[model samples]
Target: IDPGHGAQDAGAIGNGLLEKNINLEVALKLQSRLHQAGALTVMSRTSDTFDSLQTRVSKGAQASADIFISIHANANDNSGANGTETYYDTTYAAAHSVKLAQQVQPRMVSALGTKDRGVKTAGFYVIKYSRMPSILLETGFVTNPIDASILKSTAAKDRLASGIATGVSNYFDVK
Candidate 1:
């Protein structure tokens, strides 16, 4: 699992919340959930440290992870843009990545009850370069007031983690 941004790179800060922190919080929760579900989970970063995008991909590659999930909160110059979106890169495992996104996207929308921005195609470095089924999730926008409030809640973060872990389990047919 990769939680985008850290340390000096605070990602998107808005409405008194940092995207990196939120991403890490949700990822840590996801790690526990996946571990309980019998998956050997590996994190790109477990603490408030910095890792380059290349390093992030390398970690997953070195581990030979079956799939990659890069978790991130969204931000926009337009604060009105609020919702959850999942992205997959077609340059590599097109069908697999899209399938992963298809499974993950609705779960996130349902979990957060945010706007359904739906799954999209994007060439984000982590997802694109990783040689496994990969997805980058935009889990609501910190720049938006409503999303910021929801992101601030532990319950909301738990819900998001639950949704993602369930999605991964379902995808892998792990019961």
Candidate 2:
């Protein structure tokens, strides 16, 4: 699990919420859920510390994780662009990434009751270099008031984490 940003790199900030904090909270929740389910999880950072993008990819690769999931909160200058989306790097592991995103996106929408921005292809460094079924999940746009509210709620974060964990289990047929 890779939480998007930390420390000096605070990522997106809006409505009194820091994207880095939200990312870590959700990532930790997901890590706990996966652990309780008997799945091994390797976290890029378990605290409010920074990890280089290359280091994040290295951790996933070094662990030989079956899937790499990067948790993030989105930001939009428009502030009206609100929704949940998942990203996969088509230049790398397109098919597996897409499969993971397909399983994850709708569940996120359903769990958070957020707009469905659907899955997209991007060349995010961590996901692109992971060499596995990798997905970078934008939980919601922090710049949007509605999304910011949802992202700030503990219940919503747990739901988001649960949804992602369920998606991962579904991807691996864990059960």
Identify the leading candidate in terms of lDDT.
1
Question: What lDDT does each candidate get?
Answer: 0.93, 0.92
Best by TM-score: 1
State the local distance difference test value for candidate 1: 0.93
**TM-score per candidate, chains pooled:** 0.98, 0.97
Candidate 2 residue lDDT tens string, 1-175: 9999999999999999999999999999999989988998999999999999999999998999888999999998898999999999977678878998999899999989999999998888998888988999999999999999999899998998899988888878732
Residue 172, model 1: lDDT of 82
Candidate 2 versus the native: TM-score? 0.97
Error of 1 at 43 (Å): 0.3
Model 2 weakest 10-residue run by lDDT: 166-175
Clashes of each: 0, 0
- How good is model 1 by TM-score? 0.98
